[model samples]
Every structure is written in structure tokens, then in C-alpha cells.
Target: MLPKEAYDAGHYVGVVAHSTANNGDSADGERNYESTTWQNAFVHFFVDDQKIEQVANTDYICYGAGHTANHLGYVQVELCQTTDAAKFTKAYAMYTWLLAKLLFNRKLSVVDGVTLMSHAQVSAKWKESDHTDPIEYLASHGKTWANLVADVSANYKEMEGTDLKLQTLILYSGDADLQVAADLAQHFCCPIVQVAFATSDLLLSATTKYQVGGASAPAGVTLLSGADRYATMHAVLTLLGK
Candidate 1:
């Protein structure tokens, strides 16, 4: 078992993102491995294509980066590695969203290299850990550090004001669907979000939900979907009397 320790800062100052560096691993597999080797190193959460699995409580510190980051009270999360493009896409969505959720939960703004950082940033800044990860792996999937930051910031913005009223929403999965969804959103004055799964954390309460292409909205969301993308767009437009 890992030793129990509180952060030197009392509460977490920010979040650090890491990758398992072991290709083709799932969150469950990573958590299982950490279960044995946690004394060496571990993080709070592991994210893969299917789910975000919590391995340790973020209320306490976990030994992920180096002593500097750990003692500074930075919440660390690991992204499980995968080779398959589709799986990587799915996992990346969840990973970014999870990071944003963590920051939002703490009421922290998404400030790249400060509040939200890649493991590479942590290594470079602290100089205690020689490891730089998730950066190269993300580049393999055609994503840049800027891209991750933008996505996380977007997610953070969407989740910023839960008390605000957003009566309608448009959700899309692919590029084509996004075009249609964008048109509908502009026409109907509804918020639009890209989603990867039926049970996405991005789901917000709305009187009507417009789901396009592959992704499904969460259950009991008053969803409007069709047999196809065009049909779904048509349904949304017609319902709004377009």
C-alpha cells in the first residue's frame, strides 16, 4: 500500500496530466498495475476510451510527478495509452473533459502551465522529474498541447455556470454533424457541444436535446435523434418550425 500523506499546500493548487506510456493499456489495467507499484509512483485517476477510473482520492496527494509537484498539492491524472485511432479519439475526449471537470470542481481557471499542465510542463518547470510524457503520445494522435488546452478551456466554459438557464442544446459527433448542428444552433440560438458517448459529462439540463450522427445523449434527456444525420437535422429544424 502507498503511504498516506497530505499535500504541503493543504489543498491542490492545480492539475497535472500524464500518460501511462505503456501502449494499449486500459484504465483498469493501469489502476491494477498501480495497485502493486503505487509505492513507486501513482496518480489519482486513469482515463481510457471507456471510462475515467479513480485510483486514489484527490483530497490527498499522490506520488505522480516529483516531490515538488506532489508536495505543492497538484492533482495528477494519467491517460492510458492506446494505438487504435478510434480508441485514442474516444479516450482523448474523456481525458480532456475529465481534466476540465477537475479544475471546474476546484473552481480553478484553466490556465495552461499553471492550473492545467501536461506532465512535460511539470518536468520542465520542477526539474526534479526527468520524464516528459503524454506530449509525444498526443502528437502521435495529431493533437498538440495547444489543442488540449483549447479543448479543456472550452469544456470549462460550458460547465462554468450551472445556475444559468440553457433551455436547448445541440450535440454532434463528427464533422458533418457538427456543420448541421452549428447551423441549427445558430438558427435556434441553442448551445452546441461535441460529444463522444451517450453518457457524456458535458450533458446539461435542457428542455430539448438535438443529437446528430453517432453519439447519443444521456437517458431521459428529451432527446431528438433520427435514423440518420439528415433526418435528425430535419427533425430539429421542423420542431423549431424552421
Candidate 2:
């Protein structure tokens, strides 16, 4: 088994994309190889034309990148090498989407050299590793680093748009309001904060904001108030479509 380690910061700051460098390989094949040589090197995920497989837990660090990046907290994903144009095209889509999804999940914006990086970029920036991978491999299939960045950024934006619509923050003032807000928050998988305890950063992060009961929310926030508790719950459920 690959040794388990946490990132220096306790959470990943970005994602590093790499290619296996061995052509005509699938995620399963690459994973099997890594399974044996995990002490030398291993990544959190592997992607191929047909699937994306998690060879290790992303919550912890992997040995994919170099010492600097692995310690600096980057979630690394490897794309299995493929010679076929069709296979490359399919794997590329999944690879970019996975990168975007990882960044999006962390609430990190896709900044090429920072939030989203190629192995080549990692090597050039840190100098901890001399390997420049996925660059020449991408060129072999008519794809460039710029292409990957743009594609991942596009996917990130798409996810942001879709998720923002569902993202919500619920604020409650009183005990009764708290009970209702907690239920709604759990149902929607959102956060519930007391009106007095709400932070500006937390409030601003959510696109859809709600205030339960007669609690006053910030200027642009939506207030869910009704004659009684059940009525307020109804309004909240109706507005949030829960």
C-alpha cells in the first residue's frame, strides 16, 4: 500500500495533471503497475478513454508529483497514455472534467499556473522535479497545454454556474427558526448559521441566501417570513424547490 500522508496545509491548494508516458495503457493497467511500485511513485487518480479510477484517496497526498508539490498540497491526477486518436479524445474530456471538478469542489478558481497546473508547469516552477510530461504527449495528439487549461476553465465555469444555483445559506434568529433552518439546511445539504453569528465571508460565498423567521438579513439576501413556523417552512420549501 502507498504510504498515507496529509498535505502540509491539510488541504490541497491546486491540482496537477500528468500523463503516464507509457502509450496504449488503461487506468486499470497503470493502477496495477503503481500498486506494485507505490513506494517509488503513485497518483490519487487515473483516467482513460473509458473510465476515471481512484487508485488512492484524494483526501491525503499522493507520490505523483515531486517532493515539493506533494508536500505543498496538490491533488495529482494521471492520464493513461493512449496512441489512438479516438482514445485520446475521450480520455482528454474526462481528464479535463475531473480536474475542473476537483478545483470546483475545493472552491478554488482555475488559474492556469496556480490552481490548475500541468506536470511541466510544476517542474518549471518548483525545480524539485525535472520531468516535463503530458506536454509532448498532448502535442502528439494535437492538444496543447493551453487547450487543457481552457477546457478545464470552461468546465469549472459550467460547474460553478450549475452549483451556484443550488448553493444556499440559511440564517435563523430564534430557537424555533433554528429548528426549521436546520431541517431545511440538512435537506438541501446547505449551511445553517444563526443570524447574529453569520460572517460576511460566509454570507458572500453563497449565491442563494435565505433568512428564516423575522431575522433581518443583509441587503440582497432573501427573507423567508410567514405568519407562523409552518408557513415559513412552506415558503422556504417553495422558494428553494426542496
lDDT, model 1, position 138: 94
lDDT tens string, model 2, 126-192? 8888889889999999989999999999999999877755477888867888888898788778988
Residue 85 shift from truth in candidate 2, angstroms: 1.0
Q: After superposition, how far is residue 74 of candidate 1 from its true place, in Å?
A: 1.0
Per-residue lDDT of model 1, residues 1-242, tens digit only? 66768898788889999998999999888888889998889999999999999988888999999998998888899998988999999999999999999999989899999999888999999898888888999999999999999999999988876545466777777776788778878876988887664344445456567666664555545455677877877766776788
Worst 10 residues of 1 by lDDT: 196-205
Candidate 1 regions exceeding 4 Å error are 166-242
Best by lDDT: 2
TM-score of every model? Answer: 0.68, 0.70
Clashes of each: 0, 0
Most accurate candidate by TM-score: 2
